[model samples]
Target chain A: MSFDTKENTPGTVPANGHSDTTPEARPLLIAIAGNPNAGKTTLFNALTGLRQKVANYPGVTVERKEGNWKFDPGRPAARLIDLPGLYSLDATSLDERLAREVLTGRLPGLPKPDLIIAVVDATNLERNLYLVTQLIEYNIPVVIALTMVDLAEKRDLKIDVEKLRSMLRIPVVRVRTREKTGLSEITEAVRGVILEEREADAFWIGNAGIDASQQADEIHLSLSDDEAANRQIFARYKFISDVYQASVGTFDTERANFSEKIDKILTHRFFGLLILIAILLLVFQTIFTWAALPMDLLDQGFGALGETARASMPEGILTDLVVDGIIAGVGGVLVFLPQILLLFLFISILEDTGYMARAAFLLDKLMSRVGLHGKAFLPLMSSFACAIPGIMATRTIENKRDRLATILIAPFMSCSARLPVYALMIAAFFAGQTVFGFISVGAVLMLAMYSLGIAVAIAVAFLLKKTILKSPPPPFVMELPPYRIPNLRTVIQNMLTRAWLFLKRAGTVILAISIILWALMYFPRSQAPVADESTAARVQLENSFAGRLGQTIEPVISPLGYDWKIGVAIIASFAAREVLVSTLSIIYNVGEEENEESPTLIGAIRGAHDSGGAKVWTPLTALSLMVFFVLAMQCMSTLAVVRRETNSWGWPIFMFVYMTVIAYAAAFATFQGGKLLGFS
Target chain B: MEKIKVLTLADVAAGTKAKVLRVSGSGPVPKRLMEMGIVPGVWIRVVKSAPFGDPIEVRLRGYSLAMRRNEAESIEVTE
Candidate 1:
């Protein structure tokens, strides 16, 4: 049977191969489906290196990865869509439902794929084949790409490919994606099937046991939809069992395997929780220690660039905008890249090695107590690096309420963007002080701030679960995939992709926001100029729009131990929390005649005094400000992502209000309480 | 012939093997469990329980799956 060309055209054409005009020259659409941790992504990355587009599916937070793969030279390129990894077509979660719709051509804007490449984990064939059986029911032409065959052999499980092919009546290509072997054979098989244009074999219907056929028919004829579904499911499983019996063999004892030997301690009741905490602590320590050098280099590089721009350009608004607004603002956000990259590196390794699932399993009990699934833990942990990816990672949580709760508390994890604010404040106020003789007081204060964020996040999550976002915790049925040595290429590629996305935002969104803030603080220059440059700078700032706005909000924030300058920094930081540092630098550095480097930005902040000649940034004020940063919903990008993920402004707006109120009250208490305790 | 002892998967002690007699729940949980190869006649073993004894891990079909005890309660098993 020749394939129906009209029904198989992909919605998007390959950008490089658009010149071909013949109907036979149309691109072929192939969708890859598989269970999670099956190396489907590795195969996809091998087939389409750096040529894929990752975007969200319409109206959902699930990522859509599409790329073009050329089977052979001069052959029409086939468009490959990597559908989300799912267990079955039962379609419980939004991602699974979307995968189902795309497979069946029910999702709008996506045509039915001409062929499906079902990536099956050879070691776990019995479970992976469940999805394959469901795919076979769709009657689409399927080419089975068997991955992890070597691993299966190591486990002493031998899978007879030829026997499996004859039994199932389909092509099965053994592939080792990391070594990039057997890929050409898979492509050739796909090309052969597409050219031959064969229909799905009806072997399953005829080869089924007579009893199963009779049962299926009876349910189809007389039963309701749910019963019919159950009957169909039973039939499929029976068929899978028959196929397994014929083509699969095992030689090892059915006892504890290597993974279990490791899991004995990893998943132990007491040790597992301790190990989890230790691992998280190690991750945090690495993020801070490893990222310090690169962060300092990035900071100095931006500072030098700003200095060069100031020395080269003429004294005008353009020079100020370029040096202070664009460089400083974007640099503020970009400086966190080293930490974000390291975070994703650890996350990618954890995921690639299959420990993430075990982590989820270990955390399920604690998470369920807070009305969330264990899967929510990973996404929330990811928020400590940055909330954008953390919000995106929430798609793994199947339950809507749990996912929302995770997304809502994700920003409270004290992301790396808040690092600059805390570092600057602590250096200014708590430097040279030591706790416990050897421990730096600043470091202790930083750790305490981070702990406060986690504590508040847990409390808020509990409150949300009890009130607005209340829902029964969904059953946590997750697979703990066997561990494998993580592929370095895959982990590095993932890190690079995330870093590129972060840099892209820095160049575009953060760049624009910094320019706007700069103009707000730069404009409204007085017609009559003052003689002294520093006096002119102060006068100019007071007359500007941002300055007036900060003064207006001064009364409101004064109770929290913040003056107009801090007030202005808070307002500017709404775009990104780290902008507060750059805002203070620009506000204080203006019209300074000295060009010395030793008296750094911290010294400038420490030297500044209020109108009454009292110190503006006391230890209490600094602590209060850090607390405010830890609690406040300050990042616009996070709000935008939350809006996009939830498909509404309501949740993000509500999040902003609640977080701001909490931050205000907490900071207020710290300042007032500290004053009463004689700290000031 | 001997009568097999029936117990819900939740009541089945860790490290004990049993065959699923029936998946009794009616919603998505049972359907999902069946999809993952937890059906009648499939042999399964309780691998371990979480720290608080809510979610228990099980080994079946050459892979491991972790589910809450309440969800496991729906799976009728016989040793």
Candidate 2:
């Protein structure tokens, strides 16, 4: 069968040598389909073994991951598509639509799957079978891989595989994916179906060729249940029952899902909230603790590299660009990679363990009070890592208004990139001040920034609820999957995949942006060098493009106590938040040096002064800077993601403008207000 | 009838039936409620309320529905 090139729009390109056309000549198209949390992903990962492409579905935002695997011992290989985890063929969510589209050959560029590998959670058979029975109607070659058998067995449930096979007339393979027990058999069964099967008459393929438009219509029409709709549903259920009994086996057991037990305690009203708070606190603490060593190492390593470059090269513009501009600007941001990865690692753990949903359950009531949904909580929580993924995660929120609101407020959460800037300022300006000798100034400043973020998010959400994109609250209908102990293998794999994505972006987007900034600050040399290293660097920078640009814009930001240096840092940081610290470092000429002798960016800021000998970074200025960073749209990646997520530049542009204005105003207030209160 | 505020199904006593009067919020509320088979004509009965009145289990349209207390508030009901 020839694959329609236009149909596969989600950016999934097959890794195999076969051309886009004529997929039939290459390998069998096998789709692994099942209910969410049914071990489908595990089975796909095991079968494919690393040959996979993660992409999006065309015309929709659902993630599509496809791979190739040799299921049978003698079979060459089968192209496997791991469709989204869907509860039913009746697509409600965007992800479900893509899964259904791929299965039905409606999704462009993707060949209609030749065979269906239905991965069922053996423990939740009856519920999972609802979809499997629907797939059998498609008359495609089908193999049932029973997963989570270990959990089923523990719950005292036993499935008669032979009986089920006879009932369905399809090959049945039982496998425990996490334990890696039934992989070989699953592959063998798939091989048997592909190699040993007769060419099924495509024309006579049961009800499998049901009209797609009609199905979509039916799904749309079944939105409500009056007595009539209720009867219609019962009729559908009857049809399901006939197919279900004909194709599935019987299992009886008191399966007490561990997740349910944990939910009872953990999702308990009081305990659930407490646990959530404690978890967030722990994550915050761990992010600081775990990232410190690697951060220091990266800091020192970059500093040394810069020093080496400076020592080796003759003092010229090229040398200045390499040591002062590039290393200073980019190295500053790169040091935070450890913290970002750790933050994602924690998020991945929660997601894999399925506690994230529970956290949503606990927080939904509190969040909904402010017009946010429970589903929005995960994405908002993820913003603490980075707003780009957090904004992308809004796809989980099905309602358009809810998703938009969530995206709008996500950046307001204190992301890790903002942490370095906060830390530098707090350490520099608020070193030893104590509130009644109980709370340190650093601690208070940190609390204030975090609190400001939350407050701003709430206010914006409230305004959005009342004004733009106004809507009644979306119905909250999230499935609480039976809790399973997170498979460490899967968690680690997912974390690596996500971290790799971040690093890739860092190497590409951040790298390009850093180079451009370096070039901008290296050109248009000053007439002559000044006495001190810092003064010489500053004068030369002011003559450069970035420096000149900053000078032009300095007047607008002067009220907030910022000079051209801070203005340039703000502009550079717009590419990514962590760049703020590094841009400032570069502007201060904190190039490569020995770790012990090299001054930290924090130290440089403490000692900085303008031409008049007045301190450049005072307590008031530091506080104003922190407030600006807290409210500003400093991450271009996040803006780009918002564009993709919203499918418009309008919202992202609006977000950027509104946030910058807020940041500028807040900083102005803090600085001028602090001065009025005699803090300066 | 006092048009008893549609408390979360958890807050309602077991076996008590109530009519959905109106949903409190705007936008996507209808789609959400409709997805749950909670159309205006349907009468729902509280089957069980979890501790702390959250994710209260209710029976309607021949299926068991569990909703958080906040979700329940969106569905204005009359006893």
Candidate 3:
């Protein structure tokens, strides 16, 4: 039967020598669906490289990835949407629901796809076809893009493409994205089907004329006890087994495959644990060694840019605001870009190579102890670099409560931004001192602080899962996909897409927050000017809104052994935790120092006095401040990302209040408890 | 007539083969397990357990799937 062009969206011309175009041409919608780790991503990238846009589905954290592709030369392009990987058409998860909505043309702004490409992993034929069985029911022209045929054939499983095509009543194109094979064949098949729909009904499924997805749920709800579903499942498999047995030849008792051989060593109980730790160490080292130089260069580049703007521009509020507020805000955003890109590079590589699942498998038990999924391991590990990327990485986790709990406790990993704060506090007081007569006290304290963050994170995750964010332990049915050498092109493409999303979604919020923070510290310009510039800065900070607010909270912080000046520093650090050092420098009237390693900043901290000529600096106070930074939610960019990820302000607000209270109580305990132990 | 032994999938050791008799749970766990193609009369082989020993891997329908022992208990099998 010929396809009806009238029912399709008007004005979208099919360029296959048959044009019924009117006015403007809107692209036809095509969709690609498959199971996770089935090489669906590779095929989609191969078809639509660099032409894709990744965005979150409206008001949901699930990503909606779409790209434009022309089926053949001189043909009109179609918008190809890569749906989330799913096991079935049933709407048990949000991803599945979204896929159904789009499939049924029920989702707003997205029409039903004019064509469907089922990316089937040839090695896993039976289960993959289970989805294909449901796809043909939609009455859309369906084509199979069979992937990994080479791997399947290597296992002595021979597949006849023509027989498969005939049995399934659809076109089957064996495509290997790496070799660039079968791309045009698949395209031609698609073009042919789009022009002329499949006339013969799929005889295997008795009622193939009706859409099963729409009825499957209704039937499932009404039938109630699994009989209908089991029957349907068996019927589909019965049909599948016939096609499989006819079109494929299997050599039984084949020797262990390459994946099994590799897993023999990689997943060994003792060796697997050691290798995992080694890989983690490698990741840790890469962050410190490779990302360090780029981070430093970005830091210096932004600092120099800010200085040049201040030097060349005229003295006014606009100059200060642009240089201090806007430029610095943008700097804070891009400074983390290197870390985010690096984190995703590793994550994408691990995930593509399929080792991430093994990592998850190995660590699943330890993570579950804290009420988290095994996949939460990487996100929490990468949070030590920065929570922005870590929070974004939680997309791998499917359970809502587990994902939120992971996001909430990620910042407690003591990110790199907290390093400068720790450096200054340690150098000023604990420098050159030895704990237990041999170990450097500063080093011990640093390790203790990191340990403290880890301890607090585990506790928080446990508490959250037991309390409000509680849910049943998600069923652990994971497929160990065959490992492949990571494709650099795909890894980099995914990395860049994630990095761009971070800039657009989280960057703008950080810019706005920085301006407000600047205004808080910049407003009510003291009409009276002082002779000394440094003294003028100190005086101005004391009168600014932030200064007064910090003073108002001085009594609350006093129990934590902090004065109003320290309170102001704490407030300034909200935008960026590293700003604590620079804020202390300005308040102490030291030079404009940003680096915590600067000797003058530490020296100033060592010999500062309050209004009563009492020593404002004490060793116990430094320890308390370090404890506070370990738990406090100080970074605004993290909160911005949290708000976006949770799709609500409520979670972020709750996160902030809980973290601050915990920080306060911990700091109070440290200061008050240390006094009892006579450690001052 | 001799009594036949009924064993859960978890009792199947690594490298052992078994035929799935039935999936016996009514919770979402069994529903999901079935949705992923673990049904009655399928021949499945126990692959291996993870380093932690709770979630064990099984090869069925030519692909390896990992699930916890608790969920695996729902699948009644006979060697």
Candidate 4:
């Protein structure tokens, strides 16, 4: 019946702070609360570093992060929930409301936290403590974990801890996350107050709810809801400013701080853009260069694994199911691991170092001009690696409309999954052709596709904001946190966690559908006899269930300059876009087994002819197919993730329908118009 | 003191310091401004604008905050 006792992760504190009293009362629920960039996450990570689980709150997209706080060795670790960072509890946004609900036990299924670790920054005490004042009003025991003390000290500022403790009537523990000190004080304080019932001196703020209204009457002042809120706001500030003045001392030095100086150039109107472009280019280059080797290794490794399974196991239905269906499917899902990890690695580093906020700040104007939140920038960029993680990243945008807007347009970013399709198309048709002597035709084609995706995404985002998901422009109030050297441990841990989540969620669905597609293409065993395995394989693919489905849909897709074979590959690619390459390879007998980038695939596709002996893959047809892949919602994994993120089937289905219609229309134009212009 | 010309935060050029007169208009912007400590009498300084000249960064309460021009335009201030 315990969720805390079983998980004693390594590197936990040996907590012998106080003697055990409660045997096992369902693990004390402790909540960690603070402002954004106040080192709340650092403290939470310090307490519960590697032992954490991330899940969604019941119906909302707000992430619920929980970990174990092993404060005392004598007692089981307490459950530490990291409440969403907010400025105050005066809930204006849904995120704020959800946070308040969880804090006050108003949220069903989640008990009110037994104690709160109010992480107040030593540097930004005023804004941070404003939340603390609101927190202590709930009558829960509050322990102030003063973070960023080193930074505060470096700035020649000293915080009077004793005075602050007395003024707030709570335990103020000065903890340095960098030095790993003062965490024991936090445990001892929690134990003294919660377990030993050591109440503090009377607090400054009155108890929660209706206090200001009662205080209004105490001074014979009538109040509206707005005025009452204003009084409460001013009262909190009045007390916070008093706490700030009495508890903080500063030097008379007047020099520009290190962070401010860096911000000057990073936010410069001209140089900032150049630097941003340079950083983005470097990140994109690194993603491609670093991920290529691992991706190729995975591809070959899976091929060898399939070959081994075929050789070892008897050539029966189960072997085909295992080697052709399951192994290939699993490998396809796992192949995305490298790019996802690298993307998340860079993202976490930017987020942990606090440069993400600066990036968001720099991009906010352009984003807003298109009616998107600045937070949408990171997620949209992440879509290029894969849209599943990109969709997950959209949770940071608190506004529902904006987040949905970002999600709907994210798939237009030409994800890495579609790269094989584009490469195959370009290599088959546009190879060895160039505009001038400089840029390769293949390179130009790739750039045009990427540019097309970006352009379409921007247009779709603007339209979404102006229509279905419309609202008054979303509020873009973001904090540019002081930059820090990213902690390698935290960054790696975050990257792994995100990559793992992608695998766990998207990976499962992909495996299932991959098996289903395998079945559809495999069933009704072809009894056709041929001169060789290649001929038998090609005949089997032509008579397979998926092949029949492709022939049936020929009328619908033929106008796009696609034949029945292309139809089969396109249909198979609905489960995952990358499968188009392997699917085409199988149907064409270019290889006995599916190898996505087999150099022969290009030649096979280019030399292919229809039933009447006319060329099947003209440059125009290849271009049209690439256009369809660019605009189509071909990946079931993205739809599954969209369902989870939007928490509804409607949005995903709407996304699928609109994208398919657009993709079909655009490809139709490319083919019909090309023939009309005598290109084909 | 000589009469100081009034301006919304949007009108205050970068590198200028101004004390908030009051947060005007209704809806979530002003409410959020209050939570961020943009209430009356607290002096705030505009640090800079973003690359394309928006989302101005302001310093107050020992931290930096960035808000769009629309949000900033609502915060009436006096230099």
Candidate 5:
């Protein structure tokens, strides 16, 4: 019945906790709360290290991260809950609301914390204090985990922790979570607060309970009726001032403030946007260059593994299963993990360093000018990497119109899932021509497709605003946090966590799908016997369930310049996008044979032709296929995520159907247009 | 003096207010405009749209933000 048992810990238990052999004692619950990018996550990771579990909030899509950590040396089996980052207790977005809900015990089955650890960004005190003020009202024992003290000192900001602690009536400790310094002090402070069982200060409730109308009365108890109310309402600020005087110390303020000066340019109407675009372009280029080597290694490694397995086993169903089903299907999805991880790495860094909010600040005007809310930019930007997260990110946007519009246009921004499809086609059709020195024809084609997606998104957004999903624009309220040095540990931890999730999925959903596809193309227990098993195996696949399905669909796709084999590949690829490559590998009898020196995917596609003496994968089919993927929502996982995020099956189904229609129409137009031009 | 139809976010300056008259696109323009807080009844102020008209900057709800210009023309505003 206990969620707080030692079993809640994910990894190894601490050495101190291992010595405890008696019956259970009440474990102290520590809740970490902070403003976004306040190093709350860093401190959580530092405290818990690898002992954590990531789950989804019951009905909502917000990530639930929990871990176990020892507070006191005497009692090392205490529990730790890493709460979501929040700006204020008056929550607006789902993330902030979830944080508040968990803290307030509104979330079902989530326990109330015995002690609260308020992670405050030292460099940004005034803004972060808003949340601290609210948490004090909850009457919980609080220990202020002051973070980014190093940056605060460099910026000429001074903090009198002792004075502030007296004013707020809470234990306060300054720690640099990323540097692994002051951790013991933080733990000691947490232990002190928990063990002491400190009661909330009366002034905290007195200050926090005031409203705008009664502000004056709280401060001046004897003031006249209206003035008395005013004092009551303004009492909160008075309390804050008292706390500021007590706990905080002053330092020399004459030092250079790089953040403000930088923000002046970065948040500027003209210069800021140019920098953002330039950064985006650089990111796109980096994704290609940095990911290429790893991608190639993965492709070769999977091929070699399949080949080795085939060689070790005798020609039988087991060999086919290992080579084609497991290797082909699972490997197809696994190959893209590196590229996805790299993309996530950059996003995590950008977000952690406080540049993400600036990017939004720079894009607000442009979004508003287009009739979209500023909050939509985050999701749209994420869409460039992957639509699933982008769609999930729509929760951050408060306005219904803005959220819907973002969700609708997100898939239009070419995601990493579509990268494999585009890469395959561009390599096959436009091999080695360069538009400029750095930009090749293939790159140009890719850029053009991306450009087209954006253009179409804009047009679609405008049209949709006028016709459907029409609502007045909500006021754009966004918090702009000051920049701080990003914690390297936190960024790496984030990257590793995401990569682990991807690897986990590859073992389950992707593995199952891959095996099913393998069977479809591998079986009906082929009866044909021959001396040479390899040649007979190729003929047996042609008689399999997948082959029959492909043959049935061939007549429809014939004019699209695809053969029965291509048709089969397309069908099998629906489980995932990159499966197209593996499906082609299996269909072309390259499943068990690993030869990098032989014909590559592009070469095979180019050499393929139909009985009519026309090349099957002509430039037209390649173009059509690229356009199809650009417009179509082919990734079922993305749809599932969308449904989970939106909390509605309607949107996912609509997304699937509408996008598929768009894909078909676009591909049809491309093919017929090419035929009329006599290119094919 | 004549009241000009509110030009695109490109034509506006930081800290200036304009009334949204009509969004410029069929469904796409208005849909995007609505999403960005530029609906017909809402008055918008250009905070700092980006340079080269890429991500346009605007202020709403007492905050400043920037977005793409292509995203902006969809909103027809009146100053």
Candidate 6:
């Protein structure tokens, strides 16, 4: 009933500046607004240090980041809300609209900000002031945090901050976050403005743009909201130019500068695209080679821990569950952490340095052909590392239709979780074969599988854009922020945050699902005595709940060249694609009782035969299995993330059904087509 | 006196400078264009074009902006 608690109060200041309010008093909310690449995030990170929380705005996928900033011991801590960067308040995109809504008290669960710290890029004062001027019209107290003054000076332009402050009639704090200069001053300015509760002066609205003002007034009476917004936009720009002329001194336009020099080669028509492809190849190669050692160590460590648990515990259901269900299941998900970390590292660096916009610009033509924005390219590429983060990264796409389409197709990329399944199959079927003198046949096959995933994703995006998600393409206008060296602190912080999320999922959802799956395969122990341990183990598995389910589903999947055992693995893999390899290893190892060390799981699979005495996992079947894993919506975590991101079960359910249908059809075609081509 | 020729932003060649006459479109597109400082009197230079010439880069207001040709066509400019 108390929606307006003291903590949620919009702009209430204590009557006495020296009042002994508790340190736990409600913190004032300050929202930081700026254009992309204006060093706003850098300033936020610098002020908050390590006290930030990243969450989604209610009912939207745009990230809402808030941190606590305590400038002085005597003053109340201020809660800083870092809104997504936007060019203006006219709200063309969802991100821009969210900022506008939060400022105007339209968004639920968020109060109107008490003070706005408008981070303006001093180098681009004319354009950055556009948003600052718009913020003034809302009647909220505004403090301009001027940044990039060094860059402006390097360009031979000098800015008189005192003159600008007098011209705008607002407090202006020139800040250099890198040098740690003027931060305390900005904080003091914020504190002063908050205590004073000063209101913005509506100087531009009355005196400037007289003709435009008359036109806006005439149109404001009869026009709809959209037309009125249009009228206000022109007036705001006209006012910004007048402010630019009065306070800014000397235009230095003689030099080409460093950014233009870099752009010449990076945006070249032919060479630019070639460099992009080479960069992608290097990224993938690093993921495979650089992460190989860490992945192997993790795999061995998990295997050793499972073995130790099995050896120490007495033979019983509890021991089997501990070793197989819990250890194997959680380990399966954690094995890809290294690859995920590296992927995010590369992405964050690219974004911080401002190359992402250029990449999007280069790829816009091809992406538009598939009915996606160029921004979709990076998210789709990230899907190859893992789909959960990739789906979250679609926040960069502004249009709802484009974002949804990108999300729906993101899972089609072959994620790292499927690597184990592909490796197992390739080792069984394609080992020792080579195309040229040097390239291994298995490596070629792996590349082909990755290409297949990308090809299918693009084709599906093309189809979905033209049909179900059809809408006119949104205007593609984006800023290419000047290049800067990525701050090490922000990159590492992002990498760790993503890694923590993955580990937490492994600990909770994956752990519970793994335990349940163990019970399914371990229940209904055999009553009749068997001749040996291997026979007894086989009988117990066949009579278990999972075996019965696999048998029931075998008839449906036979056309895809899968047997009951393969069917069981496929069903268990619905929790995670990597579980297919672990499930198969368990099924094969349980029925073998010979030698000190168990034969490799690949050998067991190779030795498997059907009731008719033909080898079960032939080359065609292995290829078909890989195809199924590539396309299927097998990860429960991805589905859960999609549900959360879209804020509805409808899109996740639709995604699951469509992906399953496509995966089954593709596998069936591959199996039947391969058989016709005389591959056994 | 020769009449000044007014052309859309898409008609400007790379490295050429043009002063904006007006932004002509409806909906949020025009509003957004104006917000990025493509107003009646600002000068913008065509910086570069993408491989297919769909999304082109331009330098204006001391910053770089990339926009599709369709969106650029809405901005009327005089060379």
Tens-digit lDDT track of model 1 for A68-165: 89876867778899998899977679888899888877777776677899999988887788888767656678899999999888787889999889
- Fold similarity of candidate 1's chain A to the true chain A, as a TM-score: 0.90
lDDT of 3 at A249: 60
Tens digits of lDDT, candidate 2, A1-680? 10122122222323221335554466778899997788888988888888888766776656677887866655567788988787666545677767777876767887777788899877666556656655665556678899877767676656677877765567789897877788888777767666655332221111133443353345446643233223322333444344444544332322234655566677666777788899998997998899989999998888899889999999887887777667765676678778877877888788877778777767776677778887898888878877766776787776788889999999999988888788777777787899988889888889999999999999999898889978776566655666667877678776766666556545566666667777777777677958887677667776889888898999999999999899988887787776666667667777423222234766788888999999888988989998999999887767766777788999999999999898888999999999999988
Off by over 4 Å in 3: A1-25, A197-225, A251-254, A434-439, B1-3
lDDT of residue A635 for candidate 1: 86
All DockQ scores: 0.68, 0.16, 0.62, 0.62, 0.09, 0.72
As for lDDT, the candidate ahead, 1 or 3, is 1
lDDT of candidate 1 at residue A28, scale 0 to 100: 75
lDDT of 3 by residue, A298-379 (tens): 9899889989999999999999999878888778658767877887788889889989888888888888888998889889
Report the C-alpha lDDT of model 4 over B1-79, residue by residue, as the tens digit.
Answer: 8887789999998888899988887655677787778888888888888888888999888888999989999999998
What's each prediction's TM-score? 0.91, 0.83, 0.92, 0.93, 0.78, 0.92
Model 6: lDDT equals: 0.81
Residue B22's lDDT within candidate 3 is 83
After superposing the true interface residues, what Cα RMSD does each candidate give? 1.8, 6.2, 2.0, 2.4, 11.6, 1.6
| lDDT (C-alpha) at residue A387 in model 5 | 71
In the range B1-79, model 5's lDDT, one tens digit per residue, is: 9757658755767667787665554432333233323445446677554444445556542223344555565567777
C-alpha lDDT of residue A586 in model 5:
53
TM-score of decoy 3: 0.92
lDDT of 6 by residue, B1-79 (tens): 9999999999999998999998986776776787788878888889889998879998887888899999999999999
Looking at candidate 1 chain A, the ten consecutive residues that score lowest on lDDT are A1-10
Please tell me how candidate 3 rates in CAPRI terms: medium
- Looking at model 4 chain B, report the run of 10 residues with the lowest lDDT sum: B26-35
RMSD of 4: 5.6
